[model samples]
Structure formats: structure tokens, C-alpha cells
Target: MSTVVNQTTPHRSGSVAVIGRPNVGKSTLTNALVGAKISIVSNRPQTTRHRLLGIATFAAGKDAPAGQIALVDTPGLHRQQGKFSASAMSKVMNRAARGALEGVDAAMLVIEAGRWDDEDTLAYNVLSDAGIPVLLIVNKIDRLRDKSALLPFLAQVSQGRTFAGVHPVSALKRNGLDALVKELLMLLPEAPPMFGEDEITDRSERFLAGELVREQLMRQLGAELPYATTVEIERFAEDTSLKQGELLRIGAVIWVERESQKAIVIGKGGARLKEIGSKSRLQMERLFGRKVFLETWVRVREGWSDDETALKAFGYE
Candidate 1:
């Protein structure tokens, strides 16, 4: 009698760096794939200042095998020249983007539909030098006025370049993502899941709490003012007094470079600061799945963004 040989399918798991220029919706795509708001999103450029991991695990499907994708969501690659971009903080952000690409099995080069410039080329060059498989993600196609123009745009970008796969997607509307996920998973190596299926991110709650507050700053503040500020979580602790669930008490300090900037963030009668805190608390509760009691203070840090030491203290690395 012939014995039947048992065969098992392999699981694909590896890291993929999300590479793009500023304001290209890299973080939005990262969160969409992870099924959680691990990275914050805003219209302002360089909103993502640090490297963060977003883990996405998928079940086996008709077209794709089971896999886990550890997304290294990076700071948008940008040139350092403008007053905002020339600061020490900007240099740190660029370094963080390059560093996050180390040891990744693949990369997703995200770009806005119908737009490509020097910064985008800079990002593509960095990824190409890594010698890893790249998937070109043409994001925000839904935002384009002429959807028919998408194909030509994709063709223009892919002309002299090599991509493992090309996908047009709307990260905000969740369009064309199922196929994108399958394409990305195939680029990874066959291995067991590196992270648990339930894990959406590798960042700690304290780190995420601070980031949520910073996200509010980027959204609510004036263009130049937001660049001058950063959020520091002074305290994060759980209060288990409630019967329904534990309450998270978080304290955040919005650090500004000047006293005038502090006044701007606080607004008249502290209304602006209150709005920031309220919105931030709501986002924290949504992400943490628990009640959050948050307190915010605007403090002057005297050019903290340009200070390397201050950047390290506030977790720039």
C-alpha cells in the first residue's frame, strides 16, 4: 500500500516599507491595511515624523494565501531647504525614513495620482537602492477629477522603473485594496507569522497617545504653526475604577518653540486648546477601545524642533 504524503502550505510573513513623499497618504494606506489607526494622518506635509510598524494579517482567500505583513510606515521622504524642512527635526525625519527600510523584504512606493515631482523621485531612488521588490501604489485616485487619466499616469511613472506590482487605490475609500494586499503578500518570503494576528501595531499605547495628540495639532493649527509644535505624553496610566472597563488617564504637553506659538495654540479663553484636547481624547478612545480622560498643556520649549537633544528626549529616533 502506498502511504499518502502530508503536505502543508507555507505562510508568508515579512516587513514592507511604505515609501513616499510628504502628504501622499502613506499613513492613511498603512492604517487602512492594518485595520486600525496605528499611524496618524493629516494634510500637512511631514506629518509622520517617526517610524512606526503596522501589522496586517490576512486569512486565506480564493486568490491569495494566508500571510502577515509587517508594514514599516516611514516619514515621508522630502528635501531639506524650506524653513520648515530645513530644521534639525526634518533631518531626523529623513534619517528615520531611510533607517526604517533596513531589513525589509519589500517596499510599497506610494504616490498621489496625477502628480510626480522631485521629492517623489528622491523616494523612488532610495527604495530602488535597497534592491528589494517594490509595489507601486497610485493612491488618491478617487481624488482625481478625470479617472481616465490614471492609466497614463501609471504608465508614465512605470516607464523606466521596475515594479513587482502596480495598483491604483483610494486609501480613504478602501477601493482596490483586496487585490493590492494579495499582490504585496506574494512578494514576501514563506514563513510563519512574525506577529500575532490580533496585533495591529508594534507601538506602545503611550507612544500612540502622544501621536494622537500631535495629529490634532497638525489638523487644527495654522500651516506654519503646526510645524513648530510637537506633543509629549507626560503621563499615561490606567484607572480601573469603572465597572464597565478600565479608564485611561493621559496627560499631554504641546510643546511650542515660542510663547507666541503657545498663545496661538491655546487661543482666546483656552478654546483652541480645549478643542484639540477634546478631539484628541475621542480619537484615543476609538483607537484604545476604552474611555480616555485627557489633559493638555501648552508649554514653550524654545526651538525644540531644531534641537537634536530635545528631539531625542521627545522620542525622535
Candidate 2:
């Protein structure tokens, strides 16, 4: 028998950059749009280091424009070139910013409702300089009980500059998201479907798995550990059970900046490492819906964030 090949026609869709300060629900919105975990989200600031693309295909929906919307999740914009450090790490962040801003038809600037500070202004400035039309997304409105409290901030932000529109939404609570989606669809260029009917995200399974692990690490180890850690999936194998069973074994390497940090990650007698592994495995299994055997190890790479070679290996380039 001869093998058959199928080709998918790539739809012409516009890109929208989701830019904001760290922990402002940018990744959460990306995942919400894709209807899957295309980007890893956590409470830690600057959790995302790369620009991730999540394709939202809308053939026919209440808010469907001419076609679909491709949402680009970007790293948080912050001051990195100083004694406080992480400017070297900010190289990746800058790459993400540039990647999302370039050739995007529209952009979404996410901000927290309770607090709008210098970082928020800096993020807006970066996008303004990019010369792209932006939709101001005031996220986490659910955090405010009065809800009217956001009006002052919105009006102030609006007066400063002209936005496509101002939308107060809570990506965490999934409130006012419909309105946001409608606004996005109206702003999105009229194009065809970009991906298949069933395809939701642009990231590969392995990449998402790595991000999930990173998110769990951030959640467990707090701000200090996750920022210093990077995960690389060394081996991924899908094997059928010996008899009528299904499971997958995933082996990955978790890289840290220092051995001391490694000690903290591993914890006393490896308790912390085990906890990370356990939580990560559950997430992987949920995403894959199969028995997942995940193995994690810690390695040290000095200045990996600034290393071009290391960045290339991690697909930052």
C-alpha cells in the first residue's frame, strides 16, 4: 500500500501582542483565547521568557469577525539594565517584546486594576514606541468589589493617549472576557482560518510540557527558584502498554544558575525535587491524558540567560 500525505492551507491571520508587566494575566489571556494552556501562567513576575503564539480559530462564533485571531503572549516589560540586575536575562525579554510588536495588526496592553505603577507606564511606552494600535486591557477587575473604582484609572489612562478601546476584564475570573473578545474580533483583520478546525494552539506538546513544569516550579519554589531555573525536555517517548494499556515516559533536565540554588530546589533529602516532580507529572498527565512518568534533574549553567548558544538551544532565537 502507498502512503498518503495531507496538506493544510495556512490561513492568513493577523497577530496581536499581549504586553504587560509581570503577573498581570497576559499568559492567562493567551491560554483563554487558545482554549488550552498555550502559555504557562503563574503568580511570579516575568514568568514568560519567550514570545508564544496561540491560534484562535473562529469559523463562526458570536464574536467571530471575518475569521480567526492569533494571540501572541510576550514577556513582561521592566527595567533590567541596572544594579538590580537581570538585564542579561532581559535580552530574552526584549526579544519577546520585539517579536510581538513587529508585524502585528493590533496589540493588547494588560494591566492590574488595583495597582498601576511605573512598570505599567513603561509597558505602554514600549508599545507606543512600536507604532502599533493597542487595546487597553484592565485585567483583574474581579479583585475590586466596587468595580467603579476602576473608572478613575481607566479615564486617566485613556486621557493620556488614544487607545482602540478600554476594556475592564478579569482573565482569572473569566469575567468580561466576552466583551474583550468581541472588541478583539472587531479590531482583527478580516482573514481566513489560520489553522485546522481542531487546532487550538501553535506550541508543541513538548514545549507546553516544559512550560507546565516551569510554572509548577515557580508555584512551589516561589519567585527565587523559578527565575533561576530553566527546563529542557531531553527525551520524550510514547509507548503503548505491554497489554491493552497506554502511558508515556517523559525525561527532562531542569537547569539552574548555581549549585546552591540546586540544593534549595532539591531540598533536604530531595523532598522539594520530589514534590516538584509529583505536581508536574499530574499536570502533564492531565494535559496528555495518559500515564506520564516524568524525571527531573538539576544542572548548573553560569549566565545561561546571556549565553547566545544557550539561548539558541532553548529556542529563544
Candidate 3:
């Protein structure tokens, strides 16, 4: 038998929260759903510490009219220990982390295809308490050799809970995405598009550019450095000299948590920093559809992750 749905009428749209354990591919799924890079992807756990928004456009689906459903990519909830600084920034990312199910019409509980543990249980408990309709998203299935291993685990998670659906998806490979989206649309309430059809996300260009640079750094530096870094775009301009051409000038800062990390990011006499800048510039070009001149500065901000004020400066709060 099929699961019961709250919305029976067609053309429904609403906000859905993507909540999951760390490193379960929440950001990757958000990016795929929007068909744009709205969130940053890192192999390192806890890399996402914000509520990134991805707008999914629906048109003439089986149960709904053309509309947009916003996907909220929440931070991975985790158990923390020790002292936590209470300040402005701590209030933002930390807020996103703890309030994953707040204000969401539905929830997507993402879990690793081959790994399940107490953390998943805790996350589901939190969502269940919030009373949001959930859909189990078994992600990273492409990494598992024996796909059958996920069936029993899926049953375990779905037991005693009201789930809208169960889907196996590989965000990295874009597998099973269409069906997932179709299901989501069916679950949503029909309404006029909240955002324009051309709109992909709610984030500003400056924010996304900064995230793009940070993503490049995360990819190149691996797990060690991805956790300690943040990027902020100070200036983005289209060079006035080329009125008829597409050329952009972007200046950004790369913040490291410690002086030693700063040195490592800068590399031997700045070679590594240059590579990071070049790669980031290429991504900016692809995103902005223009030639990009990107300048990067590396600086040290001690304990920014735990510092609320500093986290606010980096948009974590």
C-alpha cells in the first residue's frame, strides 16, 4: 500500500528541509535539485553550517501546476561537548544546526547508503518530535557494491514512522533524481511559483562566489584544511573598460583558523594560494559568464568556528 499524503489537490508548493547526519551528501543533493551550485560540497563532515536554499521549479506535474518548492539544506546535527562561545555568529550556524525541522512543511531524512547508526536515530527522533512529514533519502548508493544491503536498513528507519516515500539516490552521479523530484512535487501543495522560473536559489551572487572559492579550496586541500577555512568576496565588478565584452574583477579573502593553517593555505612562497585563486577564478567565469580576474588574500582568524562574532562575519550566524 502507498503512504498517505496530506495534499491531494494538484499544484502544491512549500518548503522542505533536508536534514541528515554529517557527510551524508545534503549539500550535493541540494545542488542537484536546483540544477545549480547553490551549496558547497566537501568530503569533510560538518562542512555545511548554514541553511542553504535551493529553489526547485515544477511545471505541469501529475498533481500540481507549475510552481517552485524551496529546499532548505540544513546543517548536520551533532552532539557537541566543551564550552561554546555565545555571541552573534554562534547564533546563526548554530541556530541552523539545532533547528533543522523548524518552519519546514516536510523533511527529507538523508542517510548514508551503507552506514546507519545512533546519530540517524537521534535525527529522526528530533524530526518526529517536530511533526513534519519525512521522506527517507538513501544517498551515496553508488558507493555501495551490494545494493541489497540497504533494504533492511531502510525498513528499520521507516518502522513506526509516517514516511511520504523512500528513494535511493546518488547525488554525485545524478542518479534517481528525476523520480525523487517527481515524488517531491506530488507531495507539495499546488500554488503559483513563489520565485521566478529563472531563479535558481535565494542566495546572493557575492555569497555564492565566496562559496565557490571555498569549494575549490575544500576540493584541493582535502579533509584536513576544508574544515578550517572560510571565504568572503570583498568586491565583484565588471570592468568598465570592456563595455561590449564580458570581463569581471573579483577580490576575496580566505580566512584560516590559525597562522600555521594560513601558511599552509598560502603554500611555499604563495604557490598554493595562486593555484587556489586560479581555479576559483575559472569557476567564477563559468558562473558569471565572463572573464574573471580574481585576487585572494589569506588571513588568520583564531577560533572563528567557535567564536560567535567571527562566525557572524563569515555568515555562519
Model 3 regions more than 4 Å off:
1-9, 61-65, 82-94
- True lDDT of residue 202, candidate 3: 83
Which wins on lDDT, candidate 1 or candidate 3? 1
Question: Residue by residue across 235-311, what tens digits does model 1's lDDT show?
Answer: 89888677555798899999998988989999999999999999999999998999999999989989899999999
Please give the TM-score that candidate 3 achieves against the real structure.
0.89
lDDT of 3 by residue, 97-120 (tens): 557567767889999997778778
- In order, the Cα lDDT scores of the candidates are 0.90, 0.77, 0.78
lDDT by residue (tens digit), candidate 2, 251-273: 87888878898898899999998
Candidate 3's displacement at residue 245, Å, is 7.5
RMSD after Cα superposition, model 2:
5.8
> Candidate 3 local accuracy as lDDT?
0.78
What TM-score against the true fold does each predicted structure earn?
Answer: 0.95, 0.89, 0.89
- Write down the RMSD of candidate 1 (Cα, Å): 4.2
Best by TM-score: 1
